[model samples]
Target chain A: MTKREPFFWITVSCGIIVLAFILLPLIEMLSAPSAVMLKETLKDKDVVRSIWLSMYTALAAACISFVFGTPLAYVLARTNFHGKRLVESIIDLPIVIPHPVVGIAILSVAGKNHWLGQIMSELGVRIMGSVTGIITVLTFVGIPFYINAAKDGFEGISPRLENVARSLGAPMFSTFFRITFPLAWRSMLVGLIMCCARAISEFGAVVIVAYHPMIAPVMIYERFESYGLKYSQPVAVWLVLVCLSLFLILRILALPKKNRNHD
Target chain B: MIELHNINVRLGQFRLKNIDLNIDSNDFFVLMGPTGAGKTVLLEAIAGLVPLEYGRITIAGRDVTGTAPEKRGVSIMYQDYALFPHLTISQNISFGVRYHAKAKSESGSRFERLVRELNIGHLLKRYPETLSGGELQRAALARALMVEPQVILLDEPLSALDPGFREEIRLLLKNLHESSGMTFFMVTHDFAETLSLATTAAVMNNGIIEQAGNVQEIFQKPCSTFVADFVGMKNILPAIFNKHTSRIGSLTVEMATIPVDTGGFIAIRPEDIVISTHKPASSMCNSFYGVVSAIIDQGFSYEVHVQVEDITFKSLITKGSLIDLGIREGLVVHLSFKATAIHCF
Candidate 1:
């Protein structure tokens, strides 16, 4: 028997090109900044405040998605209704639409002169240039990632598990809490991480909606535009390192115990 | 007792119409049907998982048509076991204790007893994905039994078991029923399982119950061609019957004992037919001589297919008989069966 070859090297070359495309820039950004410069950027009050603001606001947005998106995902996974595909596509709209357009879309509904904005303003709640506005924009752009991931998680579970739980003297809510929720937690957590990552990195929507309470992305852009590349590089590196550490920690927490294997 | 009166369920393209079933208390009722026959749908309706568009369900003489599954005191064990993969065996078995507080008070000892009963004590700390198929089944059964449900619905309980493990589980299930006296409503397509385990059996076809009666009666006398064919009766010969006699395969069978005027099919079980080399002067209503077309070895018994004219009759004989008669292909043999053994439908 003859061994076939050549196509293996071709495939390996293509894979290497793709890997380099993703890794090269991240490596350079992490290494290019001097240690003193990175430390100085972390010490800057405005830079420190913006990073804290970015983390808390993104975390808030992720929590909101976790609360509301899980039920929508469960419905999509378990039930059949007319226009379900249409609903899924609409949920997915933010991912494909331009980020600035997403900001504009939120603006039209929640802007100062809009009907919802008028009601909120009458109640002394501001939508423009507020923390609520930042979180809103973050959630608007980051929801699709959360919902899609959580839906995949719910879909991977067998409906029989829920049915069996129901038959075993558990009510619908009880079964969901005891059976469905725990089984799908891993996927939901991953989705939450992605949503937070997307929210933290948001620039165009956050810039348009609430630039006064600047997030990390907008601050980086402002530093680059007003000062120069050197001013923004360290802040960018700081944001990246913080997000990378948080992502790793959350992922580790979500991992199953070492003794038990996943299904 | 559980009764489903004129139940109608429409799920996508498969519709179940006018399905009426009566399961007495403590009766091991098995619903036997081919795939896509809505057996699972019927069981789900009884358990209140699937809604019924028409008719009502009465359990223990109470109208529970609108009751939830948990409120109905019913539980279901699925074919895949459906044990929670994240929970250990002990937690999974004790899951329903919170709802039934009366059972909860005694759950400490009951939990130990159940794990001992199901032979899953050593697996208490392990996750569901780590257990084998039989272990999963036992855990699922333990979970269902822990709730102390009145009616237990099983969807092919033994279907997921290996051939060697199936008999053991069957014995275990039989013992559980004898001790617990829980009304079991099970659905299976395997006839052997139905015969060995069921006290009563219902044959469903195209979402309709063709026959439901005692298991032995249903096996011996199926009322329809569909039931007869599904119950492992191979000789279903189409025939024309007058008031006195019905002619099948160039032979006349006396119809005075059975009341049927129109033409229908005669279903004879293979095991009921007696095979011999020569014409024995026994009091059998029908006899025929045919050439042996094929002798199929069925482990415990041999299925001898004989060609009598254009009609082929299959007779089941013991391996000992196959050896004693020296039955082989192309040999002329006499086949005889009593008039009572033939079922006309």
Candidate 2:
């Protein structure tokens, strides 16, 4: 009700338009079909299985990143060595490369007939047409988020804190787990959540890596191609609903606690 | 005992070269220097936080050149306290004790003793961010002391606290040192801190030790211009010494002895120069008549700057003496000092 400036109104109107451009399509897709269609999509066994597969593979991919990415992030944050910048850029390569290009790149190394694939097959860990392939592609596309986030978290911690711990009789390994990890846990958690979200929504790479064990995005594409709008739209809505709800819950969990330090 | 044999460290633009230092057992040795003088870096080297590019460090006669910080039995408290933000006060104090097997069994009693002695018993549940600077300092001190290290390194421990709180911690540290007879190596730029707490001190400049001696000796007889300037000696004049007579500009100074035959710099401490309205019949070998140029009230005393011909000599006078002499800017006064007071370097 207070008199607003002309520029203020202009900016507000532009923001609303952009917000509507994104929200309107999602709103239309969700409301396009009847509630009964959404229920039917939810009840479909293939739909249910694909959704579960996406969640499981995404979680697995996130776990794999957490195991390896943590130490890499700590090293990146704490030490300087030859080719450090080159290593960091390579980690960020997948985030900028096209998704299908990422898929082809993974295929070169992880495909069944490739050298690494042969080694993996010898070890009884198949990479193609298996859950491992899906996870590999998902992890490849998602690691940048985890490594970069955890690196930032580690950098946020003062090296003096670790030095003090060391001076006070703490071994280097214990210092990391006791002091550095706890201090950086919040940012690392946020990174893990981002990595998981990216993995869950992956489609192009997963389709090339493992087509038979269909994740949700591939199933959506397959339905749309064969059955057209009526059948596919409802499934797309159901996927969006499931992804959105899961994203909300995970993001809430990642939110810092109230007693968190202001710094 | 802590000894550094020709320690050299190159960290970007600042380099500490050929730094040799020996701190005796149970001595509170202070390293005083200007900012960017690598005082902190030297302390870090001793604590094993920085790699020594050359030379060796030995503690208690053991050559610990390649030893890790945890095994060195030396602890350091940083300028900003560096308390672990994730840990409670109790946990932070106990962190070191709990880590070492030799100390773990006795940690509980040690923790209680430290908390009680440091007067942080009631703040056990608090985090570092919730505590004041003084509290954080005490917590950090407790953490360092809990390890019972052979040597404790303090990096500008009082620089971050308020003046009143600085006094409080200064007294607390003094008492601890006296009671425990523990060797402490502290780095500070404040001369007042050095005077009050240091048993032996070193003056450093550009990553090199300029002078090292007993605290009072270092203050009264600075060996170099850098040491004199860094120690806040205001009257460093270019003088020519001949026999026992040193000529500084137009003022002829009679000293106990001359270090050089021709050109040298004479450093006269401000407190050593006595100011009066008239020349007194005393055994002061050097006296000069001058007009007061400026008067600065320094809380405890008055800094009276006197201009005799070309040179301005600074002298510290008690407030009561200032009142009696009624010295003001442009007022004529006489300055006198004993023959032994002039330091030539």
Candidate 3:
């Protein structure tokens, strides 16, 4: 072993404090629940349904963002026009707005008095106390993460590659599918995971939009409020475990290929 | 054949103004200029990669000003090669066949021929990042040629290679052009490349085409001071022409033909001025005695700078001649040249 410097020890001490701050509460909650208590919590039908709903709604939100945000991300990466900076700022607005404010903003546009809400009502679409409302809130909060990540990925690729493809008789659409997408798909996948992880943890916006559907975070809050710490601990532990696995996968995918361990 | 008329393009703060050019089929045309002279921009405009603010472009007698790059019947290769990293060399070379029906039918035989001729057959399964610079260039050339376009544009294809690879690729390009009879438009800053490969050439400076003509004519009789300096004419001086004689500094030199303008510049090639220790009884129209001020060793030859009154004349001589004449700085020497050797513009 090499001799350590004073600065190295100081940095390690700071890193340990940060890590403990994040991991201590989760470790305590995970260890507080008995094996029998965890088994019984998994057997509960309501717990199962809420956890499944959270995962399903979050996945749906990620898919919706992927379908809609890709073209916008590519355009933002490749071209420059009037108000481009303003448009980029607007894309990031969701991250800065308060969660309840996002919920209220969506409700204002979807209420019965508004023209858009009236059209949605006539078309038999409801944005309150429904699965649709849950997905809408999740996607509203998660798409910024997806667009920013995907935009960086697209920017990493050289436009000269596309120009060469065009000179070889491939049209713009063909070049996107054949050249740009293949080179950028890994970053897009990372973006999808980031969006999904963020959506899975949302509480304030989804609770305001659709409290009855009872996703995982809302169930944990309800259990803690009605039945105190004992009932909520199991659910929180489960949600934490799910998030841990998601971030583990993200870390693995984000690593460069040579740094990844094959075994 | 390719023709560009009034080609005007504005990109950010740079602009190309009122440019016109005509390139015959089966011709190797090279564009030479200093850095930031819009040589690459002109190549991109010809390939339809950059939009023109106001211009008309025609290729093979058809107007393609509004056409897309894919429909322009031209292929361009960049200096970096720009090979698709995710694809194998085989896949990269055959990428264009899927979009053109005629190429699709003949792609197999053509692919084989290109790989064999370029000596890249063993690299078919490799990726671009693994290949050397010369191999990547050959792969890019094969990719551009796979479509059988009427014209091809190359942007400094051999610039990034070592000298041995550069010579190899240069010969390959010459042979390919000779056999295919396809028009080639290339951009380079190397005068040697132009001398060896260019049938016709043009010089650009600050987005304007300074001169365009046969390569030898442009070298021997450049139309402007910029062209003369760019082509390595070592001695260029401001002169006042009166009738058949022009006065350069304190010396008056005879001219074979007078220029249309009365007052302009005159240029002389360094090789045209001969340095002698003694005055010769030759029929040369101009002769001067000057002290040698500097002797610069230029590898294969030496440049002897002689000062004649206020004017300094440069003469290129071999090392053998340098040693035979015992030439050194501060030694007075005789400089003489024929009247026809002086070019006035």
What TM-score would every model get versus the actual structure? 0.95, 0.94, 0.95
TM-score of the second chain in each model?
A: 0.94, 0.94, 0.98
In the order shown, the candidates' DockQ scores are: 0.61, 0.58, 0.54
Displacement of residue B184 (Cα, Å) in model 3 is 0.6
Q: Which ten residues in a row have the lowest lDDT in candidate 2 chain A?
A: A254-263
What pairs collide in candidate 3? none
Model 2 earns a TM-score of 0.94
Error of 2 at A88 (Å): 1.9
Arranged by DockQ with the best first, the candidates are: 1, 2, 3
Per-candidate interface C-alpha RMSD?
2.7, 3.3, 3.8
TM-score, prediction 1: 0.95
Could you say which candidate leads in DockQ?
1
- Sliding window of 10 residues with minimal summed lDDT for model 3 chain B: B122-131
Clashing pairs in 1: none
lDDT of 3 by residue, A1-263 (tens): 99999999999999999999998987898999999999999999999899989999999999999999999999999998889999999999999999999899999899999999999999999999999999999999999999999999999999999999999999999999999999999899889998999899999898888998899999999999999999999998888787788779877887655422122
Candidate 2, pairs of clashing residues? none
lDDT of candidate 2 over B38-74, digit per residue (tens): 9999999999999888999999999989999999999
True contacts kept of each: 0.80, 0.80, 0.74
Better of 2 and 3 by DockQ: 2
Candidate 3's docking class is medium
Docking class of 2: medium
Off by over 4 Å in 2: A1-3, A111-114, A117-126, A259-263, B281-283, B296-300, B318-326
